[model samples]
Target: MRQNPERRTALTDAAIEVLAEQGARGLTFRAVDQRAGVPTGTASNYFPNRDALLTQAGRRVFERLDPGPEAVGEALALPRTRASVDRLMHEMVDRITAFPSGHLAMLELRLESTRRPELRAVLTEQIRANLQENIDFHLASGLPGDAETVVHLYLALSWLIVERLTLPDLFDADRTADLITTLVARLIP
Candidate 1:
């Protein structure tokens, strides 16, 4: 039996939302069906298992950040003024901080991939894609040498963003800007 492509996509999206809200630990076929307003068998027919559902959700997460470098590059190519860079950095921080579930799912996948060879490859590809996007920005800015370092800085800051939200103190947007700016400055050619 065939499923509607549009509905399958919708189900995957609903699964991501549920995973984000409950973490991987709480994801269930029933919950996804409820979220999608489809029958449980509908989700089971496509996913068949937790891994399949999660893997598809991971791909969709990356899809949402499409044309990654070009998108980030347009923002970077703006006037090289202080205010412009500041605005860019603030926007980047907001966008990254807004998707807690995506971040959480990535973290879980990273850990799980340690024992699952197939998952490790998928995660590796994601890392490469992310690195390439960062490298693109660095290259455009004439800072190719610092590409890997900048990527590391971003990973660290992202972890901090996640952990900070868990604490009583909310994320300080200003501090995040200062950190990224200082890092990017060091990466400048």
Candidate 2:
């Protein structure tokens, strides 16, 4: 099929929506096509196989969810104080929790990775790169944590936010920001 960025983007988004709503099992070309409101073979024409679609869908989720370099630069430009860390933490949590659908799509990516080694390798590499970027951001911002501590704490906080935002039954939403604030206070100070 001819390469069309807009069409490909729509298809990838459709894949994420299907994956988020129905999980890996139901993430088929037909499902994406149906979700995208496109022709039956449209998704397959864009993505030759399941792995390609899954990989692109995973990438799309992160691309949509991550705060990116500009935001990181702005955060790092803030004064190197505990308050900066708190602000950054709040911003990160807010970005992740602001959209439950994005987190849901990411969860689908992680689960799909568990079932597919090919997908796992791709996800693992991307995850490592993202963590490194986050660590680099925090270190540059003078957050009082090494890469290991920063990443671990961030992951814990993120998991809490995701759980609270998407699966409120699993975790209390009322305490999430407080939990994040406390974690940031301890980790940064």
Candidate 3:
């Protein structure tokens, strides 16, 4: 049976919202059906199975986050200051927190993919793309390799810090950026 693009889009959007608000572990066919204002039968008609639905939903999220070369250029173009870097890190954290379930779901997908070849393949591709984008951004910024390493470590730490802090209050964006800038500068000549 053919699917209506509009309906499929609606379902996908609905799935994202639920995943963001409720975490992947809490996602249910019935909840998505309600969120989409469609019947569970309709969702089943479109996705057919749990893994199928999750893969599609995860794919959509990953696609949106692809951060093409243009995005890398933008990141590189930003001033290399602690405030700027901190703001960037905070914004990323906000996004992850806002889409709690999607993040959790993706983590689950990552773990499951460890034993599932197909999923592992998908994850590998995504990780590769993401790594490339980061490398391009770092190189374009003209930062030294050691400084870039610090920035990478800082970024990971920032994510963990943001996860532990309350929304909007975890860290002052300007201050964080300033801190990153100072740290990076110290690493520089």
Candidate 4:
């Protein structure tokens, strides 16, 4: 197998785009190679099989979606109040929505996972770890929320993102922002 880190990352990123645009059925090595503009067989060299490619794409989506340290620091700088939590929630929605293709690829992986046990395990583990990380951050930041509140927000915001991406006509920006603020205010003590 090739050990070119840059090429591997490119291939996985291309796979993400392919997954988002074409769904699981279109995630072939050739498709990834074409999307990456690499030679045919390039993706196959990096990923042994379709499952490997899908799993890696899932990991890559999270890697692209995870906020940087600067964003985290900024969030931590806010006052520990319900209003601050509301702002944080809005920021999160902005961050997630900023990467539309990454989130769409995530939704694709989720649907694909329902049929593939191995893929299911990988996604479940990654999502759980991300959830726990959010819970830990909320607690350590002295935010106005418990673990349950975080969980509720996670669920609500995740679907809200889906609605925004899949059906933009359903909710405009102001309405979405209002929903997030209301969610945070009601969920946080």
- Candidate 1 lDDT by residue in tens digits, 1-189: 347789879888888788777777767888888988987678888876877787878887777545467766687667655445445545665665576666666666666678778778877888788768766765576433456665665676666667645552654666666766775566433
Q: Give the distance in Å from residue 35's predicted Cα in candidate 3 to where it truly belongs.
A: 2.6
lDDT of each: 0.69, 0.81, 0.63, 0.93
Between candidates 1 and 3, the one scoring higher on lDDT is 1
> Compared with the true structure, what per-residue lDDT tens digits does model 2 show for residues 1-189?
649999999999988888878988899999999999998999888888999999998888788887877986797688888777777777877787776666787788888788899999999998888888778877776767678778777678877877776678775655776887788777765
lDDT of 1 at 137: 69
Model 3 score (lDDT): 0.63
If both were scored by lDDT, which would come out higher, candidate 3 or candidate 4? 4
| Predicted candidate 3 versus true structure: per-residue lDDT over 121-181, tens digit per residue | 7777876676676566666676445445645654665455444443546557565555555
Residues 1-189, candidate 4: write the lDDT tens digits.
899999999999999999889988999999999999989999988888999999999999999988889999999999999999988889889988998889999999999999999999999999999999999999999998799999999999999999999999999999999999888878988
Candidate 1: C-alpha RMSD to true structure equals 3.2
Better of 1 and 4 by lDDT: 4
lDDT of 3 at 177: 53
**TM-score of each candidate structure, all chains considered together:** 0.77, 0.91, 0.64, 0.98
Alpha carbon lDDT at 179, candidate 2: 81
Number of the top lDDT candidate:
4
Kindly indicate the candidate among 2 and 3 with the higher lDDT: 2
Per-residue lDDT, model 3, residue 168, is 48
Q: Which residue pairs of candidate 2 clash?
A: none
